[model samples]
Target: MAGSNKDIKVAVIGAGALGLVTLKNLLEEGFDATGFERKSYVGGLWKYTLDETTSVLPSTVANISKQRGCYTDFPYPDDTPSLCASSYIDDYLQSYADHFQLRPRIRLNTAIRAIKRDDANNKWHIEVAPTASASDADTETITFDKLILATGTNDKPSVPKIEGMDTFKGQVLHSQTFKKPEDFKDKSVLVVGIGSTAGDSAVALMGHARKIYLAHRHGAYILPRLHNGRSIDHGLTYNLMTVQKLMQRFAPNVATNMFTKFAQKIQDTAFPSIHEHPEWRLSPAPSLRQTFPTVSDELIPGLESGDIVSVPGLKRVTGPNSVQLDAPKEGDEPMKLDDIDVILFCTGYVNDLGMSLLEPRVHPARNTNPAWLALPGSRGKPLARLYRNVFSLDYPDSLAFMGAAAFATPAFQLYDIASMAVAQVWGVEAHNTSTLPPKAEMERHVDEQHAWILEYARTGPVYPQLTKQFEWLAWADEAAGTNVGANLGWGAQGWTFYLRNRRLYKLLTSGVYTPHLYRIFPSEKRKAWPGAREAIERMNQQLEDELKTKKV
Candidate 1:
């Protein structure tokens, strides 16, 4: 723990949003951290790829948001649009890396194959291979005191294997494969999935596609991006900072109920008036989807003009030029479309950490299902068994996967937290206590989190009422004594004030507080409790009077 800083060597995989943030933090903390990006460029998914036509769109490769998707610490420039193009985001990321002096540490076009524990030296042995085009043919193994896996979730596009997907001759591609609306211009297109990606993609194609069908297996709770000429996401932000605290304090059930009710309210407000058909169908609101910029203002009118047809789930891809849809309502006849020229599946991605490394321990017969692990990879071996969503306890320093857990806000925030924790364990920091969580406890926590997500999803979007999941994550990180607390832009006092002063006065008066409740309080003890409290109260009164008079 007392070693010189020169002794530390950290390698971060994936130089995307999460990777870049981790690299920034590591550099700030004075650690010798290097980054490896598979792409020749810095931005991962933000790097735009084109379809046959060249119009910019949110295809698998195009950048999504420029300003909205960036780090909270470094606000995107004011000139940037809310929904930024992919190129803008890439430029922003490159600028961020440059600003933080992280460019020198990055090794572009490098790919990490496997991370194994070198038990003898208490270090990590990471196998590195250049991308196909790299001049280096042989894979080289590098040893590091610590390893951070920021390889984000977006790298792998989720394309479900429909029975006759390959038979679709006209064109079949995942949302990732989409680049411009012109590709679908004057052509019939079927956009599959109800998640934000699918929704946005469908909206984008409305201008060009001759006939656009937005299909989903289940109904999703549709809420407007704006209400009454104001941004709905902004309202959610305000409510998250205020209402959530009040509910958690005075009435827990009431707070939970509010999310559902609010979501319903938003859905109601969004339909008929804003959206053409508000009552089409309701599905669970995808939390990750909220992070992306909602459909732009220019596109909303078209959505209302009936350019986009909301269709039920896909039954099958009948042929190269046609597809079938299950009726939206039960007992209704199936609808077939014979002239569709393209199908874009916006189905979700699977979290698969390639299982080539842990073969013997995670063989199929062992019943180590990857789903059981919570972090996907091989069957029988759930990644949840690792401590703090970090190292595998059974395989000491063998592997650590960052940015695995799905979060509402930027995954980079959590990745940064994970990276810091890894740094602490590696003794790269002055004081290291990141490995405190026992493997068993970490596994239980992950299990509970998964259970919570499944139940939340099953129940449907708790909108307006549901606590912003990111806030809870921030609190969890704080309790774990991680850097997430510092990264929390606003102070905890906002929610604390709403709950303690307004909603649940009884609990505050009763002096009954849960252990979780105490984590938010300052650690210092008050001396001369009654006198100190009275003096503080007097100062508050004086401050209030001066503010009332508009005099500081």
Candidate 2:
């Protein structure tokens, strides 16, 4: 993955965590990079808002632990709790921005409204605007050697176009706009979507609302965030190479016993309709994609207590304050919910990347089903056709995205690597394999990634197997100089760093693939960003003064 540096001038859209890391890294690597944020701040989706751009719910917490959620270079403050709140996420991002001096390169209240290409030089012409709001400002046309669309999938609400949606007399909202469960007080609410937001809404709204209907087509696995008081995400480190060895050489039942013990500690919880009749889980497909064992802990408890009502996928909007619900059994007659007050579609985002920005010749995410594949008209949504989930298949290094996949893994960890790959793909950074492949080769990779993402979306919790995500990160680590995926080493104190990860190191070396004893490879010397040491030193001094980090 090597290429010649073109002294590329890059414009990154949406300065969230992904944008911050990317702009910071690109600047350090000596690229003429500038970041444009539609909002007045640096944090993107992580920064919760009441406007149309909001992505996070007020009650949101990282489904994964703080250890798993953080960037490679910066650690969360020790005071930060496990399974940290999104507010802390906001803080962590701000801290990263401050550490890297990213603000200077970032233009707040700026947006890339549209994009065009300079066919002659293989560059991108980006249309710029001052605000994401209705107040029209003088639009400017600017050009860049490359563009990174880090505007995440979560911002845009993927509301399904129901027949007679406007006819509903009651309020209709997307989970993106939901702030508190208390808002739906005494009203019967149908919370749509099946991811963490839906789970949080259903569980929180229970007992508060007159009745809570957890709507879904395909049922998802309702998982607990904390198992026996420890974050289950952090517990994944138990995947030891020695454990793999035992499963292979001496005892096959070892794996079974391990799984049972883990499962015994966990419980199977689903919407009551699906839980009571396991067969109905098949009706709403793409339902299982949102259900991981650790996605939402409160969903099951809420269901069991009769606090949340369960309904099949929404079939049709029959009238104002009325809708037809699909039955648990596919061919069964649709049931009618005549008294519905608020319909909160918990459905996930559609990442229709740069429809206005990208020319027709270039491909964006082909599957743009922003409704998270729940509706019939998902043809135009933003499930992307990205290469290795980073670069665009049609445009290669010149056009790319960060944090594209709707993954269950720690996001910033993934986004950080994708950030590095942008530089790697552009041949702007020196690494062992820094060459950008030919267009055909890049397209082939995109096709391969497209298939993998589709499969992951289709197959449920099995995708949460951390090793596969590690393999993906390893691909990013190859591009970035950080060998985190290579062996999981970052700056930490002594055995404090490697003790917990010794088994992870062994597991990385294990040859067995199952059941995810996935493959990993040694990386060549991770080339540092030009003058990275000095940059880090400055960051450390600033953080020491700001964060007051203790010196061991």
Candidate 3:
């Protein structure tokens, strides 16, 4: 059946982590696929350099462990640390490419210029140009039967223009340009925004910078990287996905209270000095269920020790060397900071969805369909009309966006599963074995999901792409005709698995839910990797061994 896709030519844009996995899945399903990357390397932003490319800081470490970070089929070596460094992640991605023989199919230094839909012939016309460092290849146009946009969400950095910023004598930069700790050595730096980057930058500057001021608009639940000497993800978060879903569904308020209470308890236990020093004003969000968390081992400690100061939202720039902050409450007086050398805005990035590359009408905002327009709060949002956050309602058969949505789970595994779903839908559509829902039905489903998202947003922060891992797995599995949930003891088929295989069932439910388990079962759409079971067992053993030694 894989041979049936030889005639289908697929073009994948952006060769980052998601793009690499997208290309791998397209090729695995036997599509004649080619990947385009603007950079010379395959790791995208993970391939760090001082150049304009957005990358991690020199001291950056993965927020999650390698077990969740790596691809399913390929597990990290036993020697790898539980928390991988940026360099390790970069090397691991390169290893993934080499192991799968994907480099030959990739065109490094080739950048996509424009993509036009040929409605008459049902093909995509893509224009590409080689970068300056690459060979002097002339710009060329290529045709493909399908297009996948893996360009990623972090393309356009969100930098706000503060009033009197021009008068500021010191340097003002976005976190995208932050390189190393030495850049701000012995200087007073004001790090804006309270996300992971803000926490990281503040903590990384701890002994280097003379003073660090962390400013934020709202409160955040700062979680520790380690709890009781074990990685928090492996010891606490990974095993609670099912419980999280159950509480969210049946008792929403109760779940919110319990989670927030537990998070506060952890914060209090980890950083006891914060409670004693009320003037520091590290007010946490009432419900962490709404906003993303800031994870760091030293951020709170730095703040508690008076090395870093926490302040309210930035109000305005007062002078070249000073800035005013908002009152913490309605009655309190506003605060001001002076002698600041650098103001690093850790404000995040907006997703770039083929804005300039594709025709204007192809964008979600320009959709004229009544059904799409009828969806509440769907207008003007680029990714709102997507069904399952992959297929386009207008051109479901020809277009899909990989790594479009943001999830707390591992990025690589999510993109791989989503890519497989795309491959399966396109692979079978040609021969009449299609499992794709009809166009109108897809529009209705998209509208319903949009409504649900709008309702969920009313409770907390506006995280449009924040999705649950199991829920995404359920949708992706149904689209690909896979029984991953059933095989892994989730949903209705979980009962059958529980009755049939008790040993595996116990491991699947109680043990770590590693990425490899997704590929452990057979599927008609995609072949099961024989090594998946071995990978799962190896990961379990590694975790057990680490726990025995307390190296976690």
Candidate 4:
């Protein structure tokens, strides 16, 4: 439906980081956009407040990379550090919302129930439910020309069904329910899983909990936030996109090996032999050699001082107050702890799109495994075939899923790219609707792209290489009718490349052209066309030469 300004009415699901950014970008582009947040507040997972069940203690919040996470047009405050807490992020989003007058369009405490396409009118019928705790509730239906699912996967915590979990007398909760470290003060606590949150939560609860047992079924690479007096996270955040590209082009194995070694070191120093855990499955993301959370100066001394202890996975919970562990060292008999006040299941969240409005489009066959297709669905029909991770093949002028990948760069950056693509789609269709590609052709293209990514991931890192971001953007921009090569120096890559390339100071913000443009364009174009197979083979050879010389 058209709005007062002849703008397209768009419904953005999820008001967290991804949603907030998507909504803001849409509004900025003169689109009549409204946001629906399941939670009462903003900031999605980043929002932190006191809860009676869990006490607040000194702990590091989700550290948003101001350089990478903030909008390109808006710079983060200079005073802000590389890592800021959830409160800081919440405040930042609020300020952005206020600055752009985006609050009025957002409907807080509103949850989306279903989204159905009206084939007759070529519109999307969205069903939204209020967040009020009522069993028999009426849902409000709204129609919009476009729908954006910014509902991030991280927002939902995945709780695995473990044997004898419910019988435990001690409180068991997901990391989402965890408020602070003080709640486990002087009590024995067992933390399950070993993702970013698990690492951060374990470190935070070190001193507070009398005995902290970190249960990991398998080994994960532990990266420190800082290395050589510089934030490794900064390197990862700022240069990750480029580094990923370099790795993809030159030394795929070297790139994977570098991160594997780094994770091994962290395992050796902090929790030796942890990688040998029977349940440890290698991560799909490219390994960061020294990428660990930035432990606050105050917390490091305590960790070394023996306040926190990392253990293997949880074997079983014998009783309400007692638990057993699959200890790291052999001959270290089955360890048991008592009087456990709280058990923080740092186990990760499941990305179930069918649970949300993306269900109707999901086919039963694909529903069994959503991650397999990189599309959101459970079992039935496919929602939309992904085109280079952005546009959908089946729907004309429709692009809902981006930043839906299980683990990659933060969802915020992906949302930015998606918004830009959406705007482009709107702009392109407004001019000539006939230029759009056929759905069948687009589907084949997407299937090929997915196959390529899957093969690439198998030979390389577990997660999409950082370089894939640039690659995807280039392809997406082209598909959206924008000149990615020309926009690189003007968009996110412009600032990013400027920071890393010392020779391009004059061209940094001048919008001046660089010679790399010529080299990059041909390489990207070759990768996009039927000649990509030969291009990739040639690129692999070049990468080997570069890696042998660099010896990284």
lDDT of 4: 0.55
- Over 1-73, each residue of candidate 2 has an lDDT whose tens digit, in order, gives 2243436788988788778878876776677888988888888778777776665666777887765566655
On TM-score, the stronger of 2 and 4 is 2
Each candidate's number of clashing pairs is 23, 22, 0, 26
lDDT of 2 at 261: 46
lDDT of each: 0.55, 0.63, 0.76, 0.55
Q: Tell me the deviation in Å of residue 229 in model 2.
A: 1.8
The superposed Cα distance between candidate 2 and the true structure at residue 355, in angstroms, equals 4.7
Ranking by TM-score: 3, 2, 1, 4
Per-residue lDDT, model 1, residue 340, is: 88
Worst ten in a row by lDDT for model 4: 511-520
Ten-residue region with minimum lDDT total, candidate 1: 523-532
User: Candidate 2: global Cα-lDDT?
Assistant: 0.63
Off by over 4 Å in 4: 1-7, 50-58, 62-64, 132-138, 236-246, 258-303, 327-341, 353-355, 358-366, 369-385, 406-410, 428-438, 445-470, 477-484, 487-552
lDDT of 1 by residue, 483-537 (tens): 3233223457544554555633322222211111212323111011123223323
TM-score, prediction 2: 0.77
Candidate 1 vs candidate 3, TM-score winner: 3
Q: Which candidate number maximizes TM-score?
A: 3
Give the worst 10-residue stretch by lDDT in candidate 2. 511-520
